[model samples]
Target: MELHHKLRRDPSWHPNACNICGQLGHQAVNCTNGTINWRQIYGDEAFTIKPPVFWSEMADKQKKKEVDVKELARRAREYARMQCQAQGIDYDEMIRGAQVFQHAPEQKPQLPVTSQQNGGSAGGAVKKEAPEGDLPEGWAVARDAQQRVYYWHKKTQKVQWDKPTKDTPVS
Candidate 1:
């Protein structure tokens, strides 16, 4: 009997399983139904849906965010390394002093000198020797290891590495 009909006939009776095949939701008549999920008919992916575009977009955004973070972290490490080198602190001694051994060095790992371009108020400038004519008047450009470009206003000594606001000039 149908679940509804059985319920009507006996109020105490409960439909715990399928009334047709006495199994789960599957029925004997529709056991081979291959419209919704074709896994019943075929064993491979037949017509899978395209993943949401935002998944790739989010991944790109995340990659950009990671590069930005690495750039900023590189700046900080350069500053620390400079200060330590000035104080004549050896790399091993500084590492022990900072107790960085407990954590992943990935956070403060030393970046290659070639990774830096511009050198001024921003860290990593020591490795960069910008030629006078290479840059426009009162303007500088720095590139990090990730190849992320940073625009420098030499006049104001201001550096912009991320998306610019409307106030920033297009040129």
Candidate 2:
């Protein structure tokens, strides 16, 4: 019997109506007709098919993101070797000292032997070297191209723009 006819015949007819299949006698939540096959009912227009993926291309992209430790170490070693060559410093010594700045010895003007023999002094214009006692152990002062003094710590491989005090080191 139709739902309206049954409802007309009996006013107390409270049969559960399923909203999914639209049938009488079970609620929509309790309906057990499984999933609705949209493709079966609506044909190929139900959903679009995606193009097949190339796994090799995806794998290559994933591999590019990962780093090889050995390759990185080799590159780092090569860079350090290049830096040592460019700076004219010993790579082994630099590696051992860790951060030590081995400054190239400054060339000083030599007084002529005749001037020394004549007992004439080189004037009072002698440039005094920066005192090492002010700096901490394994630290030294160096001048840049502008002659501005910068402190270097060999062991820590650190540089500071300000002057280091005897009691405390400048960061």
- Candidate 1 clash pair list: 119-125
Residue ranges of candidate 2 with Cα displaced over 4 Å: 1-60, 99-171
How many clashes (backbone N, Cα, C below 3 Å) per candidate? Answer: 1, 2
Q: What does the lDDT read for residue 104 in candidate 1?
A: 44
Candidate 2: tens digits of C-alpha lDDT, residues 1-171:
567645433344445555455567865444567365555666765557767789998899999999999999999999999998999989987776764545546776654343233223243222235565757677888765434456788877777654556665534
Tell me which residue pairs clash in candidate 2.
99-154, 100-154
How do the residues 1-171 of candidate 1 rate in per-residue lDDT, one tens digit apiece? 666746533344345543333445653334443234445466455436666677889989888777577878989889888988898878568768668667745654444433234333355433333343545556666766644466678667777653334467644
TM-score of 2: 0.24
User: What TM-score against the true fold does each predicted structure earn?
Assistant: 0.20, 0.24
The number of the candidate with the highest lDDT is: 2
Error of 1 at 78 (Å): 3.5
